[model samples]
Target: MTIAHQPLFKLCYDEPYLQGTLIERNNRFLCHVLLDGSPVSCHVPNTSRLTELLVPGAPVGILKASNPNRKTAYDLVTVEYKGTTVNLDSNLPNRFTQLLIEHNYFPEFRELKLLKPESTYLDSRFDFYWERESFLAKKDPASEPVNGNSCLYQADTLTENKFAGYIEVKGVNYVENGIAQFPGAPTIRGVKHLHTLMDAYDQGFDAAVIFIIQRSDAHIFRPHETMDPLFAATLRQAAAHGIKLLTASMVVQGKCVTPTLEGPTIDLNPV
Candidate 1:
């Protein structure tokens, strides 16, 4: 219930999740719950450890799937811990980042155009693709910086324009003492993303990875090297290769998400 004065946004599922108490996580993708003192099986949306959030008898919110033919009708989506609600949907981060870009939340990308989602490249799928027209700061009508001042160009003019090859979004849930860490478990897919991001950069197009902290507790974001050293090493190499890194700390207000507090530059030093 922490409030802020920045622009706000939220993602409401098909319907508000039904209140329930977490009986137990039966498996990585399933769980048992108590809704109104009756036992009911539910679906766990994410596969991460979520060690700090989910607990026996903890308050939870379950989403009811429309298809009644499914094994479990409800999908566990939200969990409350230490007075904060954490979103557990594994597929929501990309959508949330898309909305943020559309709203100009990141001033660096405010002028982005031709935003595309779910772009598939060679052996890899990215979250977004976009183009931005940038003109050289002209002291004269030449292709050079004019005392580091910029000028504008038409949308049709591709000269000096930057086409972003890919943008990958990562969701963060593991947090402690205002520090957010990623990859609650080892991730091979994540290592692939780093290589792809670097490849995109080498292809003469913009590329970056964005990490969205699903809870309000984290003040900064860092890689969980202990959990996945290979991903950490690849991430460092990707950074060295000029792959951009962006982080945002977002809060869940009831069933909605507000404009995130964009995190500072990442701490690449291995921990």
Candidate 2:
């Protein structure tokens, strides 16, 4: 695929994000921030243990919660670090990747015509399910060419004879010395995803895991062996088994986030 000179995706909020100072993190999903000189509880969007980024008195950006029934009145989304804005939202990576696939950003997915998000395979639910146009046309010659606007084909309806692929997406925010690493905390589910991808590859289906680094400062991507050795080992095993491992860096400007034209290089070697 050609280099993307434009923004891959833009995450706009309904209201302007509020600037605040982070006080402390209470748990995985909760934090306290000083907004407008008042301490208020804010919802943390990420589940990972962001130990490095959630320091006390750190500058942060938050948005007002739209749901009236919600407990927290604001959601912490962005953190300023070393002159770079790092996005902490865990849900943005999948949406960003969906836009990338729709635009044919990855060469491996150029031939694929349709995309289904949150697709189930076996006991795991992958982030994306892609179908090739040629395969769809050959399966049903009377049907029109499959496009993004067409209805999504159910995974249950698809058989092994179909040509398709599965993609799992991971979001990254932790960076050290210009290297982006994944899984700030130990994650059992992450290792499971890697194993599932390997299983799909063994079954003759294309499988890949894309890591979206939510900061532009990272020049390379690698697994955080110190933080989670199991996850790192599984990632290496998946790579050895022919599962595609990809990484991309994103730049955050004000309230908008965009992918860089040139993606980051992946390094599987232990640090």
Candidate 3:
């Protein structure tokens, strides 16, 4: 009915677009493409190491730039490999998850109030912060409002403990075989976030890290250990210390996509 009560955004990239073959990635943000057999420069939205997905001659989907003065006339939207589409925009994952959580799509996070966006904790700024308050019954006799599928009501409440939560979102595009891995390149920032989450978890707060796999090809999720073993080790330690790790895959429909979470098997100290 209202914007605040709206549903989670469904995957839908419903726009006038073009199909092209990727010719070459000039750098992190620019790629040469063959559109209708004519060479053109396209903007690659996600700068991560697209490892196996951005092979030359791969089918790519692009959205025409509305800005006439822009250097590149198209924004590379998706790369198709064996019928799978990866959202090439690194910027969309966090915003998409925010839409999901605000619309109560996540069962684990539903009813948890969205306190702030880009909340800072120590040196890191998280994607979100939610409040989870548990009231004391003996201290009061009246009821208060609550939201959840399980604990939708609270009665005879008094001030008790309120926990602040943090969510860090990671966009995952690099998949090997059937497994999705992150940090397609070495990331000093990612390692720092894992350690921060672990520290927050130890500080009596609910802390979590979410990996939004940009495509559906991955059957499992793990750290790209071979690429960044230090980060992988830190992530493993965080999980062992009770920091919540979530893996959700996007269901992309022509650029419109919603996330679907899956169970993860995170292996650290792998043999």
Candidate 4:
């Protein structure tokens, strides 16, 4: 599908982001940055390894914490790498997916309204719970048409009935050679999410996982088999079970995050 370049979400800050240079990562959630020649602690929003993006002396954009009582006064939000601004916020993908669904960006999500965010299933809380308006209505055999023009019917071949489903969103920042990949490090939680989606599909509900590449340079997306072989294997299994795998790339310019005109294609199996 072709979509015009439009800002889906804006990264707003009450105070202007401070320009800084990376010093070192103290831990998974904390890092030290040289702001104005002085080293200061900053909060890292993502838990991934990010070895490619968070190298020492790399330029970064950090936002000061709103709360005065916070231990770390700044949050590292963006990293400049090879002329591309990569957003490091792990929470932004869900928001982007929500906006995309509201805008009817995905054909499978057409006519489907978001019922709730962070909706819970058996053992996992999904990013979204969505249902079609017709799904809530009583099923009528007489009202059903022999053939339909809706793309939902054509895309999802599981059921003729209306769509209702759970979606899990993943934010990807690691890209190499124009290919975006997820789980920069091993993630047990990521594997669990795939299992939850497969279980949802078995329960007769539409289940999907949407990966939002947090950079514009990527031409396609694939599971990081080398980083986390277990997660990659499970993702392949989920796709075989009819769980939808969706992806899109975004361009981050300053504070505005916009979707590219052409979305990234998914490559489940990659050499």
For each candidate, the alpha-carbon lDDT, in order, equals: 0.76, 0.84, 0.74, 0.81
lDDT of 4 by residue, 30-52 (tens): 99999998999999999999988
- Ordered from best to worst TM-score, the candidate numbers read 2, 4, 1, 3
Pairs that collide in candidate 1 are none
Model 1, position 136, has a per-residue lDDT of 27
Report the candidate with higher lDDT, 1 versus 4: 4
Q: Write the per-residue lDDT of candidate 1 for residues 196-249, one digit (tens) a residue.
A: 778656656667898988888877678988999998889889988988888876
lDDT (10s digit) by residue, model 2, range 95-157: 888877777788888867778888776678889988887556545434443233243333333
* Highest-scoring model, TM-score: 2
**What lDDT is obtained when candidate 2 is compared to the true structure?**
0.84
Q: Name model 3 segments beyond 4 Å from true.
A: 1-9, 13-15, 133-162, 261-271
| lDDT digits (tens) for residues 133-244 of candidate 3 | 4422232333443332122223223222334567999998887678888888899998888888777666556788888888888887888888888988888888888888
Model 1, residue 134: distance off in Å is 6.0
Evaluate model 4: give its TM-score: 0.87
Per-candidate TM-scores read 0.86, 0.88, 0.81, 0.87
Please give the distance, in angstroms, between residue 202's alpha carbon in candidate 4 and its true position after superposition. 1.4
**Candidate 1 overall lDDT versus native:** 0.76
Cα misplacement distance, residue 172 of candidate 1 (Å): 0.8
Residue 260 lDDT (model 4): 70
* Clashes per candidate (backbone, < 3 Å): 0, 0, 7, 0
